[model samples]
Target: MQFIDIKAIHAHSAAQIDAAVAQVFEHGRYINGPEVYELEATLGKFLGDSKPLHCIAVASGTMALEVALRALSIGPGDEVITTPFTWISTAETIALVGATPVFADIEPDTYNIDPKEVEKVITPKTKAIIPVDLFGQLPDYTALETIAEKHGLKIIEDAAQSFGAEQNARKAGTFGHVATTSFFPAKPLGGYGDGGAVFTADDQLAEDLRAVTNHGCKERESHYILGTNGRCDSLQAAIIQAKFANFRDAEIALRQKVGARYSEALKDYVTVPKIHPGNTHIYAQYTIRPKNRDSLGEALKAADIPSAVYYRKPLHQQEVFSHLPCAKKSFPHTEQAAQEVISLPFHPYLSEADQARIIATVVKAV
Candidate 1:
C-alpha cells in the first residue's frame, strides 16, 4: 500500500547499514574522509569511464550540473538547449551558471526531447545540449551525439532518474562529456541524505571540479580556481557504498518485470511508457499518459490507491520563465503531455495483487 516501500528496503539492509555507519564513526572523519574516495573508486570502476574520469562526490544533483557547466566555461551570453518537460532544477542549473536555457519540444511516444526539434532551437550562441533521461528512460543518444558533433556542442547526460540503465551496452554513467546523477532518496541508488556526483573522461575537468566544490582550492591554501563547498558527506558516502553492494544485475532485471506488469495491465486504459528498441528502461517513475488523467487519478485515490502527476506544465509556461523568448505554442506534444501524464505507484517491491487493484481502478475510471 505504500507509494514507495523504503521501509521494506531498510528492513532488509538495516544490519549492513548499521555496520557501515559504525565504521565511519570509528574513523572519526565526519567530512570527506576515506569513505568518500572509497565510493568514488568503486563507482569509477563500475562505470568504466576510462583513465580521465575522476568522480567528484557533491552535495546534490543540482550542484553536479552547476559544477559541470562551470568546468566547461559556460556562462552568461551562452544558451543551453534542453527540454521544458522536467523538474525545475534542470533549467535552474543552467540559469544559476549564468546561461540561458532554450526550450525544445519532446516526442509524444517516448516523452523525450526530440532531436529534430532540438536542431531547430540551435543558434550561433548555443553552448551545449542537455538531453534529459526522463522517467527512467533515455533519449536517442545516437542521434543526439551526431548532432552534438556536427554543432561542436558539449553533451551533458542528466542521469538523475537513470543510473544503471543501458542502451546497446553503453550505460548512462559512461556516455556524454559529463554525466550527472542524484542520490535523492527517491532515486534508484539513493542514500540517507542528498548526494550527487559528476562523471567525465577529462583529467583537467575532474581536477577543476574537485577544486570548484571545495572553496576553489588547488591544494591546501593554494587557491588557483573559484569553487564552492560541494563534497559529499563521509556518512552519506558510507551508506551509499553499502547500498551499492546490494544493487545487482538481478535487481535491474526485476525492474523490467515490474514495468512489463504495469504495461500489460494498464495499456488498454492508459498510454504506457515506451522503450526504445535498444535501450532498457529502469522504471524510476513508471508514468503513463491517460486520456482522462485527473479523473483516473481521483478514482485510484478514492480506492485508497495513490497516483500523482509527473509534471502538470512544461517549464516555459511557469511564471518565472514566461518572458524568455520561445515560439508560440510550437511544442504541442510537450503541452499535451502536461495535461495527460499520470504517475502510478511503482517501485521494485510492487506486488501483483497491489498492481491489479491499481490497474482495475484505472480501467473502471477511464
Candidate 2:
C-alpha cells in the first residue's frame, strides 16, 4: 500500500481534469493566465473570504513564504521566529531573504511552535513569527497572535499541511498577517505539480505580493522593487481547480473519518494525534507515536504497508542551520517527537480494508 494514493485520487476526476487541461491548451497562456486568477478567486472563497482576503498564486510553498516575507519587507539583519520541528522550507525561506531564523521549541501535545517559547525569543531585531500547522492542524494562533501584537511582529501562518483545517470559524489560510498553503500533490488541497498561494487581508500587502510574484512589475516594462519569477503556470492551476471543485469537501470529510478510525483503533496501542480545541484536523498525515518507532516502521515495511516520517530531525539540529542564531538551549519536546513519530498510510481515498490491515499491523508491531 502507498502512503498517498495519487493515482487513485486522480482516477476519481480524470474527465474533469482533462477538460480543464484542454481549455488551458486552447487558451495557450501558460504563465499567469486566466486560470491562475480563477483558481485564486476559487480558493479565496473556499477559505471563506473574498472581499478582504486576497490570494496570490506562486510557484511553490517555499515561494509563497518567501514572497510573503518580501512583501512584508523582512530581510537581512532581521530575525524571524519559528518552530524547530518542521520541513526545512519553514526556516529556509527566512534565510533565503537574508534574515535569521530564530528557533523556538514546540508544544508537546500539538507539536507546534510554543507561544511562550516564542515570547521568550522576541528581541528588537525580531520581525515575524512563522508558525507551522504541522500534520494538518492549525497552530495555537490565539496566543501567537497576541504575542505578535505585543511585540509588533508579523504572524505568518505556515499552513502548508493544513489547507482544509479550521480553527473556530476561521480557516487555516485565513490566519495571521499573511498565510501560505502548498499544492505539492501530497498536501490536503494539492495540484498535480508544484503550486502555492499566499493570503492576506491587507490590501497594500496583497498588491505588493502580486508585483513580487511577477518580476516586481504590475505593468509591462515597469519595475518597482526586487522580486522573483514565482508565478504559477495555468496548467497546474487548471488541474488544481478541477480537483478542488469536485473533491475538496468530500475529501475533507473522508480524511476526518479516516483519522477518527485510526485514533479509535490505535489509541490503546500508540499515541495518536490530538486536535486543539475548536480546530478541525484534516489528517494530511495520520502520524502516531509507537513505543519503538523504528521497529514499527520496519514491521509495516515488511508487511508491504508503507509508512513515513514528517520530520526525523528538528530544524535546530540540522547541519545547515546549526550555526545559525537561535536560543542557547535544547528543545526536549521537539527532540523527543522526532524520535517517536511515525506516519502510517493515510489518504482521503484509503479503503476501509486497507485501514484495518494497517491498524492490525501497527498493533502487532508495537
Candidate 3:
C-alpha cells in the first residue's frame, strides 16, 4: 500500500481538478493569477472567526514562516522559541530571519511543545514563540497566549500539519498573532506542488505580508522592505482549490475515522496518539510509539506495508544547529520520542481491508 496515497486522493476530484488546471492553462497567468486570489479568499473564509482572516499565499511553508517573521521585524539578537521535535523548517525559518531559535522540550504524550518549558526559556531577548502543531494536534495555545500576553511576545502558530484541525471552536490557522500552513504534496491539505499561506486578522500585517512575498512592492515599480520571490504559483493554487472542495467536505472527517480505528486497534500493542480535550486532529501522520520501533518497521517492510519516521533526530541534535546553546541542552521527551516514534501508512482513502492488514502486521510485530 502507498504511504499517503496521493494518487487515490487525486482520483476523487479528477474532473474538477482537470477543469481548474485547464482554466489556468487557458489564461496563461501562471504567476499570481485569479485562481490564486480565489484560493486565498476561500481559505480565509474557511479559517476565519468573527472576521475573515487575510490570507497571503506563498512559494512554500518555509517562505510563509520567514515572511511572517520579517513582517514582524524579528531578526538578529532576537530569540524565537519553538519545539525541537518538529520539522527543521519550524526552527530553520527563525534562524534564516537572523533570529536565534531557542529550543523548548515537547510533551511526551502529545509530542507538541510544552508551554511550561516555553515559559522557562523566556528572556528579555525573547520576541516570539513558534508553537508547532506536531502530528496534527495543536499545542496548548490557551496557556501560550497567556504567556505571550505577559511577556509582550508574538505567537506564530505553525499549523503546517494541522491545517483543518480545531481547538475549542477556533480553527488551527486562526490561533496565533499570525499562522501558517503548508501545501506540500504530503500535507493534510496538499496541492499538486509546493505552496503555503499565512493567516492574520490585522490589516497592516496582511498588507505587509503581501508586499514581502512580492519583492517588497505594494505597487508596480516601488520597493519598500527587503523581501524574496515567495509568491505561490497560479497552477498550484488552482489544484489546491480543486482538492480543497473534497478535503473540506469529507476528508477531514474521514481522517478522524481512520485515525480512531488505528488508535483503537493499536492502543494495546503500542502507544497511540493522545489528542487533547476540545481539539480535533486531522491525523496528518497517525504516528505511534512502539517498544521496538525499528524492529516493527522492519516487520512492516517485510509485510509490504510502508512506514516512516516523522523525525529521526530533534532539531537541537542536527548538525546545523549544534553551535547554538539550546543544542547542548537536554530535552528528554524530544530525545526519547525521536527514537520511538514511527508513522504508519495513513490517508483518508485507506480501505478497511488495507487497514486491517496494517493493524494485524503492527500488532504482531510490536
The best candidate by TM-score is 3
Global local distance difference test of model 2: 0.90
Q: Residue-wise lDDT of candidate 3 within 13-34, one digit each (tens)?
A: 9999999999999999999899
Question: What TM-score does structure 3 among the candidates reach?
Answer: 0.99
Task: For residues 224-309, write the lDDT of model 1, one tens digit per residue.
Answer: 77677888999999888888866554556767898999898887877899998889998778899888877887788899987778
RMSD (Å) of each candidate, 1 decimal: 1.6, 1.1, 0.8
Per-residue CA lDDT of model 2 for 91-130, tens digit only, reads 9999999999998899888898899999998999999999
Q: How much is 266 displaced in model 3, in angstroms?
A: 1.1
lDDT of 3: 0.94
**Which portions of model 1 miss their true places by more than 4 Å?**
49-53, 327-329
Residue 100 shift from truth in candidate 3, angstroms: 0.5
What TM-score, computed on C-alpha atoms, does each candidate reach?
A: 0.96, 0.98, 0.99
Q: List the lowest-lDDT window of 10 residues for candidate 3.
A: 44-53
TM-score of 1: 0.96
> CA shift at 227, candidate 1, in angstroms?
1.4
Best by lDDT: 3
lDDT of each: 0.85, 0.90, 0.94
Q: How much RMSD separates candidate 2 from the native structure?
A: 1.1
